[model samples]
Target: MSDWEEDWDNGDSKATSKPYNKRNNAKDNSISNRSDESGRHRSSENRAPIRYPQAGEKRSNGQRHKHSEKIEVPSDLVGMLIGRGGANIQRIQNDYNVRVDLDKESGTATINGNTEQNVKDAYNDIEHHLNNGPGSRYNSKDGSSGHQSNAIYNFQLKGRNNKPGDTDDIEMDPSGVIDWEALNKKAKKERAARWSKLPELRKDFYNEDPEVANLTPREVARLREENNNITVSRVFQQENVSENIPNPVWKFEQCFSAYPDLLEEIYKQDFRKPSPIQSQAWPILLKGEDMIGIAQTGTGKTLAFLLPAMIHTEYQLTPRSQRKGPNVLVLAPTRELALQIEKEVNKYSFRGMKAVCVYGGGNRREQISVVKGGVEIIICTPGRLNDLIEAEVIDVTSITYLILDEADRMLDMGFEPQIRKVLLDIRPDRQTVMTSATWPPGVRRLAQSYMSNPIQVCVGSLDLAATHTVKQVIEIMDDGDKFYKIREFVRNMGKDDKAIVFCGKKTRADDLSSDLTLEGYMCACIHGSREQSDREQAIADITSGHIKLLIATDVASRGLDIEDITHVINFDFPRNIEEYVHRVGRTGRAGRSGTSISFITREDWGVAKELISILEEADQEVPIDLRNMAERFKSMKDRRANESSKFNDRDGNSGSRGYRGGGGAGGRGRRDRY
Candidate 1:
């Protein structure tokens, strides 16, 4: 039997079973503000946008209050302060019967009530809740704690101090703007301190937890190369099971019974066993429940959601007479992932359901025609979808099943506007599913707002990082030496093994590809800078095995799904550890063994050390020297933070001055590597 772990909510996939609702009663207080997060807040709305209000706006009351007297808060948090649909705010007003006026623009609040005690108590409660609560935090990692972060030791209200004769807290004027320079300086000091503590925080990854770290590099590589005792079955198995596990198989069998022919077609394709994500997700999605799938790449996530999407579409599929509606709409962060999804959907959507891939960069006219012709399943990136929506070329209301693949990346790439706009336009009764590699706080908030009691299915935690087929090696050297070593490695790779080289920038990818090609290594480069045609052609060449070596940025790092990828080379180390994982994940796919080598220069040691820590957490070996370099950076960063904090105490603005020793202005232009 294939090792399978089912998602809890999959047993009840019907959309009506779990209605999306807000937990908080107060509208303005709906968004929980964490104390440690400096003024950032989490909203209850399915979509949250950072809103900064202008000063001098009229208050809710007929009276206008001076702007400088009240504390300034981020606008997004204000909505939460008011109860659901403003009912909470009304209740507060009606209970105490206070004439409190909030001037959103100036961040000033005025209270006129029968009793000063009631008004003061209510206002203080609001302040206290925001300053210290699950919703508000000063230093919590997930921004869900009550304690103020260590970064703000002397944080104070904006209009706290006043001389008897000084006209400091005046009427709505340009004065009390929360001392932006001072706040920024304090934030910088705190961030530096937090980053410096990364080494200490890594204890969770290495503290005698076998699940966190198991094998050293030598043992893993030796075992992998020897093709020793370990078998695929041994590597993959369901360790923990209980009688309480839901009867999802029966539920799925019942829902999918009508489509015997489709089920036969699925099994005929030789996908005899469902992957972990697929096993759970397929049943739930087929039942039409909102879901949040947390699985890493290469865990068969595409098929997990696709199978159900296809099955659901087929069951409710309309004939060409009702072809104007879209049965399924899959939104991906990148064109590559979108296209990959379209391809997979097309394979399964064989019974009259048309699958279309729409994204920017290609010929829009042809794409427009494809969309207009009739497509049951549409896979697209937010940007192109928004363009088509704006042009009124496509109707999004007909979309029923919405899948946001790589959900975290969509948020990170700043697709909030487009995503919000699209979600607003879609039918409220649709089934939505979001999937991502990592679950951050922002992503969680998004899920809470958009998905209804989503079955949160996480295949493997950070402890079990990546699949075992990948061989990760980190080489530390000077910049020039690193490049030379890369050249040497490229020359030494087996001729039969295909390689993909990842760089941090388009220019670097192009430059390296040019240099490597001139040196007689067959290579093709792809990045955002290239035209749409060129990118597609480059990817086509790589997939066809026409190009043995492919160079790209993080663009091609996700969702390419080309089989037989033997090696992945990090010509330039990724800035973030998450990106590093995605880049390396391209190899060791389809049950094939692969090798990934990263060239870490002296300058990159800081980042490399974190990667090594992550690898160590995954039971991958880490070289000793790289660890030392990371420690050095941590120490340097700590000393700098301490010194900067002291300087800020004296000068009142250390952060804006920039890095420790360098003139603050000089550090702003450090993107010279590009």
Candidate 2:
């Protein structure tokens, strides 16, 4: 015999001397067939002795010899192979008559059997257990067990030529026939399983108020109708909801009766009824449940959260002397928003309920003194709050109510880390309320991580599109024509009609404001580069009607609630839809109609589609050129995305290899470190 045959014969003598177990032959034929189909047989000169059963293997009743092998198990599959109480592993050991050892930390499995086939069988069985376990099924087309035919068939089905009644046959390889029925059934099953996990309402257990729990379905429906069909949806909730949770009430009197002092204050402010957000949010928040309120700007969202927080604080009855610091904390994104919230707090600060607003660019010593003096509520920006916390001047442990107003804007302004730091100092069990004009992904992530089974209340569509209260007029023109067009629009407005001219940059706002002032238009500018005092003064001038026209950037886009502003002029269209929404929202406040005129240039083409959609949603007449530009922009975006994806795929493939062409060890040599 040749040397290779001699080696195979020598190895088989040891395997043949051992007794073969009958269970090892269960899948022997299938394995042999697969090996033959895959051309797994090596040349006779270099072949290793086969360990598994051959095409016609018989049981041997001779003395057995031990055989061993090691297999690596995926970390995620380790729990499944071990099973509960080691039941699956024990069963495998008993049935296979082999010893199996598993290293949990390293995720390695060692199998030992009296015969070679036994060890192979035990290893295969362990793999089978893992494959059938949870999260084992590969979903991507390139996955090990994923069927390329199924993916191709699905792609073909979605192709344009494969419509109903079309007799065009999908070409298939004869050697690899597609299983159409099986693929269809599997696709349907996966789709159904995915849809089964769609979001659904669950009972809320956070609020245990007996009054709120006693609410009936009939009463809830009546309240909803009275409040113009306000809806409350839950993204996530717990079971064991209190049966005493109160139903939503429409009017402020119906809800605020429990707080006579607050009710008197509301009456003093001439507020007859609650806004939609306030009406829906009061019941949930008053009952001590976390909430996310999404409403348009100037829709009374401040009062919606503040009122509940105040009522809850009153219920706690914590003495002013004993209170370590502010019992309620309201975090705003900007000094402007912080000041605005403080102004509203002052309106409702009846019967010794005091509030202090802290923000950056103000006197730190003054803010420290106010906070040290003890207040029931603290309204501040994130940066200033963090500064106070680090300085050990503010103790947030006593804070029970945490409110994040204009939350989406806060995240956009990159205040997430500061917000998180401030939250870390507060108690986790505090009732958290997040209010935003829009719900972006970042805002959603913050809500999910911080809030406890919060109820979401949306006043209108959550898209944050421009409200119908403002009429949008798109003026398509060249960059050179923008100034003249804005000037003409401003001149046409009545002298009493106040207008805000929005620019793309602070310098642009400054230059435009100067030009407008020189042209004899009463205009003043406010932007981030301006001092806080100057911004405040400019806002005051605009609010007091001393300045009929104001020029600014997106810094003034949020939480500047001036009444009857009449006009908002976009000298430069916003690059994003959210900024556009807030810019226009500056006007159309407190039941007053306003006009927004946007001067769109070539630079603003990217946002044309979204802007057009907002205009269409508001029922405004879209300009024909704007519609065409939006379509062209959409096509360009799609083309660019496709090109980018293709380029990435090419680079990824090239990166997998050591190098395409190189002389220095296949580009694997290390470079000198600096």
Candidate 3:
């Protein structure tokens, strides 16, 4: 056996049963003739370690020991053992008088029964019944079974496929062929008896529902309350389609057809429909027009510009025989986000197009090697990319396609200087495309400075943040009780549901995640201070479903795109109204409906008011109390602006200055972080 297999067998989980074959005796007159035959072993030797059964290893005395022998079972047979509500499993356990504990969270089960032999016998019986179809051996018509003696009886083990060696020889004798009619009669009688007593086994599992059992008492109550408030008719209530439809200046459908393989891959991954942003942005970008798309994260923004970038590269790429520098460059805000965009872009850039991802915090030597090898598409974070550019490790002169994803976050992270340098280093006639979740004044000004005659595309209203799939809710609570409320909500979440908690500052994000971990929640905190490797692992943990809760600062608010985040909790309200939308947008993604809940405190009344005003302008329903509170803050807005130095002098640098739109390519405006 391989070392990996031995290691798995030695774990707390072990298998049962070895393979054996039996043949009729030749000398016996009542039996048939004997023939030489070969059968395959269904035990550990034939199965891969990855799919090894994770049940029945420990003894009742709480002693854990490894079994020298191993058992092998088919994958289909294993699935049957875990019958509807695990009914078949219960029968075998009761018959053998053992205890079974299945841990779905760990993806393993434990069998605690007295002694090794009894546990082994129970496993064999369970395996035997499951190996056969429903209602054939253990399960009856309704998938039930009867209580029977738990004895480890011998049965010929068979493999799904026959042995390789040919065996056509058959020894025939009059005594060997005797009694086929009598055997059929006995088999029919045994089946009838088993069927009559199967109800007890069926009832044990038929009434069991894992979904209900998995939910906590609080979650069950919340689920019931949500359903009770709506009637069947009300649930299907439809709103009239708005007439103010967005008109795109350009549209192209067959553009991606040239790369049929790329399209097939996208569809195979189940991204069936193009998002509003993608539908609008693809045409302008494919036409080689500089454009900026303003849409929230989790709305397929990556693919919006990515498809166009890929399409353009198809025409502009250099011949494979001749090596060249990167023709397309994509710069994102954070390391995690840059890597994510790289992964998405690589999924489609096949057929001779070389795409490579470059980021900081690993091995710089490895990154340099990739750049030296020559790639047409480059996905990189600003700081790392800039370092490479400065060191002359990467050539940017050939770059004609420049994409700035999460432009707002990139600017916030002080990448403006690095962005300006990249622009200067790249081709003069380059097509620039910038995307952001929300188009605030800061992002608009940055676009004006960089893009030339660009077409602007915005999905939905600027005030309406996140996607329609995300249900938004604001709950008023005292500052002191906010933590408790959040804790209670998390405790009520279903096993499959995941939640991201957003905090205002990095320190707060770290503290909250730490606190949650200590409180028995599997969570990880991500922020600027964390190393790049750790950040990558943290994002992977959340994306791979290993960690259910993620606490992060605004660094996670934008940039990072993880699919199917069931909920987003705003532990601390955003500083700006635009950020409020980005924070909640993470939850509802990839066409899945999600929920966002924010705990509004007295200290956050100002920010809460602004958020409601934005939502109201976007045509969303707003509470009367929130609207009134928001109104109080608005009355003092102008007074506070006048007193502040930001707006004191219009002509002064470092103050709020009105935008003086730039002419030609790369306009200019007031400098702000996002």
Candidate 4:
């Protein structure tokens, strides 16, 4: 692991497992298999008797339990056949009241149950999953998965051409393998049996929130000012939720009941007090109410929801080992953010809790191994998470706490569909907390669609705004003048200063990093085109102060935290104002002062109006030339709006209008985070 990955560690949490080995992870970055049906990872310890049959367990007559013939599971298919953390196998055992175990060396499985029918059903279930491995892409009738060929049991591929350079060894065969309807019936039975054990929803856990009554409008106004313009209102209705709101926690001791581990994390991280968002969010969230936290970038949003999740997951009635799947699911927009959240989760020593970060570019097998090791929280990006869901590596149905960090960014990255798909499987009553810097229409639509009576806690104005601590400096110049302007700023840099330069394109970032290096200025660069590990290294280099300068595109704009970063230089302004806010907000983090320099050329005039608005909102100096450019763009926009019918963009994402429109690329307002 790079130092960047471990930089935040204070060794406060009892880490459940070590990071996955990277030796063979190169080949397996994504799960090739996907299906709507999924199962959960579980351990044998403390599992209900309905799941695993004990040794010598038999019918009332005291006869020996019937054992199914050993199934020869291919060595490679064992993981899926048994499911990650033995979830699939455990599902089968619970459904049929059977005992199933895998022999890794022998590559075989045995199923023992009270009746022959139970053993046979369990065997068929494993066979079905084994059959539906990555190689089998096509489904049979009713969109149901097909089983593998009988020859695969012996590690032999049937109908192999053995042609040179042919890598595909497994093939799909949909020919009737088992009674699909009968298996469905067994699955339904198992689901019902398991859900019956779910603990009742309760807000009055040992750790309690300050139960306060309704606040007068005047009191609310006063409270908002005190909490940095934070506003809390119920958005929907839930049976268990209270109309009476809870007061925000000013101190860590006031929020948690008796969690010493969490306090230890707070102390280790040197968090003197809760940020505005955390202060209010912690109270509402700890009260078990769905919440939407709107806060500025780098205002301690991660810990706001994370700390509450620790309390909820650990204090639940079910033990971590006995749970069917993860208790919490945090949907992040990017892998960097996902890994960052995982790091935050790792910093606390809270009840031996574990969390895993799964994304598209990381090793799928290694992720599966870590998840199997047992994790209560699974923090992941949408795409890879959906893939894992399809492969049954994760089961969201058991998840009770759900968080959508940067809900706007997730939708902007075109992850709405995936987010919705993931949400469909999760329980409706799960405590959901969504945090976004701005309250956009799309985010509102999503919250309305899924969340229970959510208490929306807005830390600042809901409008799109940059970090107020950063001093914004805008220079309107020719495109060619940008290079020299950035050079002058870099030359005047303080030794302790760290800066992140933003470019519009990946190639531009690479070129900038190279030209600067040749000019005797060493720097790291990152964008979407680089390998996952390489991108991580670049971030690590800058984060660990191994390098004082870094260049990147919009990829680094969201959910990246380097508190000491002194400057943000917009070498090439982003296409949209939303991205520009994210870029400049990268600096001036964690209550620190910073500076942002943007060289805005005529070509970048489209976003000028919105740029001026952001600058004015942050009380930063806006150059006269920049103001003139915004007016010019506004006139140009009015002219274009009147010129042609085709000029009317449905989302108006061409420039400053994009911010007002509050959408992306005529799709999910998502262009690309990378």
- Which predicted model would earn the best lDDT? 4
Models sorted by TM-score, best on top: 4, 2, 1, 3
Q: Candidate order by lDDT, highest to lowest?
A: 4, 2, 1, 3
Question: What does candidate 4's lDDT look like per residue over 578-673, in tens digits?
Answer: 888888889999889999988776667667778888988888888888788777767765665664434445545443333232221243332222
lDDT of 1 by residue, 191-301 (tens): 566445321110011012242135465554453234312111111122573211111231233334566666666766675455566645554565555777777787788
- Candidate 2 C-alpha RMSD relative to the actual structure: 22.6
lDDT of each: 0.61, 0.70, 0.59, 0.71
Name the better of 3 and 4 by lDDT: 4
- Please give the RMSD to the true structure for each candidate, in Å: 17.7, 22.6, 31.1, 14.5
What is the overall TM-score of model 3 with all chains considered together?
A: 0.56
Give per-residue lDDT, candidate 4, residue 70: 76
Q: Global CA lDDT of candidate 1, please?
A: 0.61
Question: Model 2: residues >4 Å from true position, as ranges?
Answer: 1-219, 222-229, 239-245, 638-674
Segments in model 3 whose C-alpha atoms lie over 4 Å from true places:
1-253, 462-464, 617-625, 631-674
How does residue 177 of candidate 3 score in lDDT?
Answer: 25
lDDT of 2 by residue, 589-641 (tens): 87789999898765566677788889988999999998887776667656656
